[model samples]
Target: MGEALRTIAFKVKTASCGGTQCVNSFGDEQLAVDMLANNLLFEALKHSHFCKYACSEEIPELQDMGGP
Candidate 1:
């Protein structure tokens, strides 16, 4: 969990800019840091064998991690 949080923090800190503003599924302006954080969390959860599920405010549904 600590490593996952650290990875998310690192991605947010290093997110790039200069792209045209884009709207997300929520119809809101998508920020680089927001996208990076989402991706980092998804990846972390996907790779965590101990995680049985995950849910985020950014996503509408739950993610199954395939854990026993």
Candidate 2:
């Protein structure tokens, strides 16, 4: 989990993707960092197999991490 988080953080800092032109759930301009962080975290959690469910402020509901 730490490695995954670190990887995503690094990507967010270096990647050129993402923008504020798009809107988020709150109707606010979506920041690149926010989008990158959410996507990276979701992917990490989905594949980690360390938890049955994962939740985040960015997501609207819990994510079920199926069996490995």
Candidate 1 per-residue C-alpha lDDT over 1-68 given as tens digits, one digit per residue, 9 for 90 to 100: 57878977777677675563567667777776776677677777678777787776566488886665
Best by TM-score: 2
Q: What is the C-alpha lDDT profile of model 2 across 1-68, one tens digit per residue?
A: 68768987787778765557477566777667776788777777777777677666566687787634
Per-candidate local distance difference test: 0.71, 0.72
Estimate candidate 1's alpha-carbon lDDT, on a 0 to 1 scale.
0.71
Which runs of model 2 end up more than 4 angstroms from their true locations?
15-18
Specify the poorest-scoring 10-residue window by lDDT in model 1.
17-26
Candidate 1, residue 11: lDDT:
74
TM-score (all chains, Cα) for each model: 0.59, 0.61
